[model samples]
Target chain A: MLAFQAGNLGAFQALFAKYQKKIIQFCHRFCGDQAMAEELAQEVFLNIYRGAAGYRPKARFSTWLFQIAVNVCLNEMRKEKYRHRIDSMDASPETESGKPRIKELCDPAPDQNELLEQQEREMMIQKALMGLPEKQRLALSLRVLNGFSYQEIGTQIRCSESAVKTLIHRGRQHLKELLENLYAGGDKS
Target chain B: MTCPYETWISAFMDGELTPQRADAMADHLAGCHGCKAKYEALTGLDQLLQSLPELKPSEQFERTFWKKVADWEENRSRRRLADWFKRGWRTVLAGSLALFILVFVSVFQGRFTRSLSPEEIILAEQMDVLQQYELINNLEILENWEAIAGEDESS
Candidate 1:
């Protein structure tokens, strides 16, 4: 970051190369749309570019980057108004498996059963995530997917450490309940 | 008894409690059915979360993103230059228009003002003549009418 601030394009490129994947994944999980995620990821980098000159070492660079990402995702969510729609759709038991079971049922790809199963699980998880409130989803994703500590999540999410913990706890509990409801017939015992 | 059990259970799960606390929690777990069930659930969640696959970016992500960044930078610079040129042109056009209007008005106001119809000029001149004649007649009548009325009254 210091090198990039010192007008080193290579350093900037290096940072971009290193974090591009992680940023893409984060945005994808947050928005659940690959194309929009990529666009938001680009926006995140652009923000970093615009703000790089004033970059202070107050927090870790990743924290700052993720903070920008979280803001972008939240702003997009607000502008799109898809959260409620997604929540309602996801709340239905049909999309509960992390896979697109409906899609599979309509078009059975016999050779790709494993792939279908994985897709189902991912879909289910994503639907459950969609059901969570934005703040809780952000907190939980930062903690569980990104492996960020509570302090780091707090910094990125602009909340207190205790508040971050509470968000994660509540988020997890919600996920647990949702999953339990969806997979009620499965052996939880 | 201070419930060493509860504290240990939380600490053990978080990996924050001391080894002693962890051991105590482990010991309590062996005897306590309720705490054991809670511990199992937490462990199950932890394992499930850990086992989830890490999502990777698509193959073309880096290339595509950097290309976009470059394009964005180029477009931004170009936009700035274009904006500057636009503002400059607008200022020049505005100044030139203002100057042309000033020169046109200054040179043409007399011609335009003088170009009123003959009837209008004639009307204005007649109005002036009428005003002068009315003023003189009023003065003469004021000077003689009172004397003439006095003579009639004597008669």
Candidate 2:
């Protein structure tokens, strides 16, 4: 980052190559939408590039990067357009009926049952994730999905380390219950 | 059923606990079924999260990003140029106006002084003193008048 800040384009490219996929994945896990994830990732990198001159190494570069990523994700989630998308997913027929909406599922041929099942499970998981409170969802994703330590997650989310632990603990419990309820509802149907 | 050790189980899994506490937790988990079950469920949840499918950027991601950067650079340069031009124009306008005012004031002063006789210039220069000339001339007399009045009163 210092190198990039000093007018080294190669350094910026190296940083981009190293973190592009990670940022995309983090955003994707945070939002549960691939397109939106890509958009947010671009915005994150653009912000980094634009603000490179002002960059200081107060924290680990990854921590700083993920802090920006988390902020971008949170801001994107707050937008009415993205909020409506999440709400629509929450009210989608698959979630309500506990059965994969035919139109929403992969090709429903018997040969594709495994694929269909996988897609359905993934969908359910995404919905279960979206159902979590914003802080829990952010904390849990930072830990389990993005693989940041509790302290790193705390710094990114602006909470104490103990608070992060509690958030993740509750987040995990909430996620488990949500997934179980989703699967149980599916089983009943 | 909520277990007091539930959050401890999470911390223990994440290795955030001290070794002594971790050992105690392990021993407790070994003897307790409820906490053990909760631990397993949490472990599965972690696995589920880890199993989320990985996504990659499309091939055009880099190209698109660079194009955006280029466009941003161009726009920024243009804006800066415009700002500089605006400042330069303003300075030029201000300088010209100041020069014009200076020239006009000097020229007006020279013309007026030339048009005036030497006596008129002196009168103009001392206009404030001249306006109070009568009062200033009588000031000493006025000061003594109070003393004369006092003498007359004594008499």
DockQ-based CAPRI category assigned to the predicted complex of candidate 2: acceptable
Evaluated at residue B125, the lDDT of candidate 2 is 100
Which of the CAPRI classes, incorrect, acceptable, medium or high, describes model 1?
A: incorrect
Best by DockQ: 2
Instruction: Give the per-residue Cα lDDT of candidate 1 at B119.
Output: 85
Tens digits of per-residue lDDT, candidate 2, B17-57, equal: 99999999999999999999999989988997787656657
CA RMSD of each candidate after superposition? 13.6, 12.4
Question: lDDT scores for all predictions?
Answer: 0.73, 0.84
User: What lDDT score is found at residue A183 in candidate 2?
Assistant: 94
The per-residue C-alpha lDDT of model 2 at residue A177 equals: 90
Q: Give me the candidate number with maximum lDDT.
A: 2
DockQ of 1: 0.10
